[model samples]
Target: METKKTDKILLFKGIKLLIFAALSLFMGPTLMTMALSDKENSLYIPLLIVACLICAMAVFLIFKGIKIIMSSMFDKK
Candidate 1:
């Protein structure tokens, strides 16, 4: 019973991570382009920072999600 609960939790966590990673990956580039555009928006600097962070987090999430899935796969009952 405990193992079943843990496995379900881990699976959901992995799926969540993958979904967020995909969203961040998609959003990061678009934000970056906005940051680099010639438009004179005052929020450009902050947006640039956010874009970089998002891209970094996206990469991190992908690795972490894969790690979680692998760990769950080999976890002892």
Candidate 2:
């Protein structure tokens, strides 16, 4: 792969990682707040769980992307 394409992939991966981190931070608190509130909502718990799972997946993807970029740096000409 060309260096430019590789760089773009790296940049995209980094952005995804940042997005996931933000979602994790936001969702955790939002869910907690909703659970504590008196109002009952059926969807909140499931959505919260999904959000947590997505956060975990995002972290995994970030690491994978880093590894790919590093390996690409060492690719034989």
Best by lDDT: 1
lDDT of 2 by residue, 1-77 (tens): 45533455555666666566666667666665665563367776776677567657656765766665665455543
Q: Which stretches of model 1 miss by more than 4 angstroms? A: 1-6
Off by over 4 Å in 2: 1-39
| RMSD (CA, angstroms), candidate 2 | 4.9
Return the lDDT, model 2, position 34: 64
Model 1 poorest ten-residue lDDT run: 1-10
* lDDT (Cα, tens digit) per residue for candidate 1, span 8-63: 67878988999999999999999999899945899889999999999999999999
TM-score for each model: 0.82, 0.51
Top-TM-score structure, candidate number: 1
